[model samples]
Target: MAVVKVDKKGRLVIPQEIRERLRIDETTPLIFEVDDGNTIRIRIIQRDDQAYTSDPLWKAIHNPVFIGKKVSKKELDEIENDQWSN
Candidate 1:
């Protein structure tokens, strides 16, 4: 229900109210579809329960501290277990 301008770079800034209502965050993924070359539909890709629970482990594996280094499965398992144990 809101009209927004597409910037020169073709990026649209979603309004704050809409973002808050839709619970959109920086990490959120969106699917954009064009229908009849006139209507644009945006769908938010939501993470399932399992993905939500493992988010911490995913983040830890990609953490800046591990950048440019290969983390072993054992190390990842330890990190995941450590998070749950605490």
Candidate 2:
């Protein structure tokens, strides 16, 4: 394994080989998660770069909702039946 130094800004410079292997670039977005023991792990958040403007489903993906509503199986069956009837 190659040794890399962390800069004064608390940023660790990834080695060239590691960077190429991870396919990381300046635009790559990373997320850090800490476990119960306070051990931090870094992960890259990758997004599908496909651009779709005409699809409503694709647009809704960016604006998600959490209404905190409890949905039941009967309600799901009713909704599916309504959709099928239409």
Q: For candidate 1, what is the TM-score?
A: 0.55
Per-structure clash totals for the candidates: 0, 0
Per-residue lDDT tens digits of candidate 1, residues 1-86?
89999999999989999999999989997779898779999988777645644677766666647358888999999999998999
Q: Which candidate is the best by lDDT?
A: 1
Return the number of clashes found in candidate 2.
Answer: 0
* lDDT of candidates 1 onward, in order: 0.83, 0.76
Candidate 1 worst ten-residue window by lDDT? 45-54
Error of 2 at 56 (Å): 17
Model 1 ranges off by over 4 Å: 49-86
What number of backbone clashes does candidate 1 have, counting pairs of residues 3 or more apart or in separate chains?
0
Global lDDT of model 1: 0.83
Pairs in clash, predicted candidate 2:
none
Tens-digit per-residue lDDT, 1-86, candidate 2: 77667789988887888889999899786767887694667787666544333457857886776667988999989989998999
How much is the lDDT of residue 75 in candidate 2?
A: 94
